[model samples]
Target: MKKLNESLEVERIYTVLEERIEQELEERIELGCWMYCKEFCIMYS
Candidate 1:
């Protein structure tokens, strides 16, 4: 029972970390896209 509880706790922590990583990746991608668009507009205009 104790082992099961420990495993559950670990899984929960891992899930939270994974979510955080995904959010950070999404934010970075969005920032990259915005920067690219800004640069493209400047070059074209």
Candidate 2:
């Protein structure tokens, strides 16, 4: 029973970390896309 409780806690921690990582990745992707688009416009124009 104790082992099961510990495993559940670990799983919860992982879930939180996963969510944080996903959010960070999304922000980074958006920033990268914006930078790319800006550069492309400058080059083409």
Candidate 3:
């Protein structure tokens, strides 16, 4: 079903992001709004 496929896709993206964050992020720190803002600034500026 379409709904089931959508659910699976969301799960897949979540898993990929979780693994990437675990592997690629700097020393374990909480993912807060400030961190996202800093990353956004770094990428755009």
Candidate 4:
């Protein structure tokens, strides 16, 4: 029972970490895309 509880806790922690990592990656990609668009606009204009 204790082992099961410990594994559940570990799984929750990993799940949270994975979610945070994915969020960060998404934000980074969005930022990169915005920057690229801005640069393109400036270059064309």
The true-versus-predicted C-alpha distance at residue 33 of model 1, in Å, is: 0.3
Show where candidate 3 strays beyond 4 Å.
Answer: 26-45
Q: Is candidate 1 or candidate 3 better by TM-score?
A: 1
* Angstrom error at residue 5, model 3: 0.1
Query: Would you list the rank order by TM-score, best first?
Result: 2, 1, 4, 3
What is candidate 4's TM-score against the reference? 0.90
- lDDT per residue, candidate 2, 1-45, as tens digits? 999999999999999999999999999999999999999999999
Report the C-alpha lDDT of model 3 over 1-45, residue by residue, as the tens digit: 999999999999999999988876644455566798899999999
Give the winner by lDDT: 2 or 3: 2
Per-model tally of clashing residue pairs: 0, 0, 0, 0
lDDT on C-alpha atoms for all candidate structures: 1.00, 1.00, 0.84, 1.00
Which portions of model 2 show Cα errors greater than 4 Å?
A: none
Better of 2 and 4 by TM-score: 2
Where in model 1 is the C-alpha error above 4 Å?
none
Mark the 10 consecutive residues where model 3 has the least summed lDDT.
24-33
Tens digit of per-residue lDDT, candidate 1, span 1-45:
999999999999999999999999999999999999999999999
Superior candidate under TM-score, 1 versus 4: 1
Error of 2 at 2 (Å): 1.0
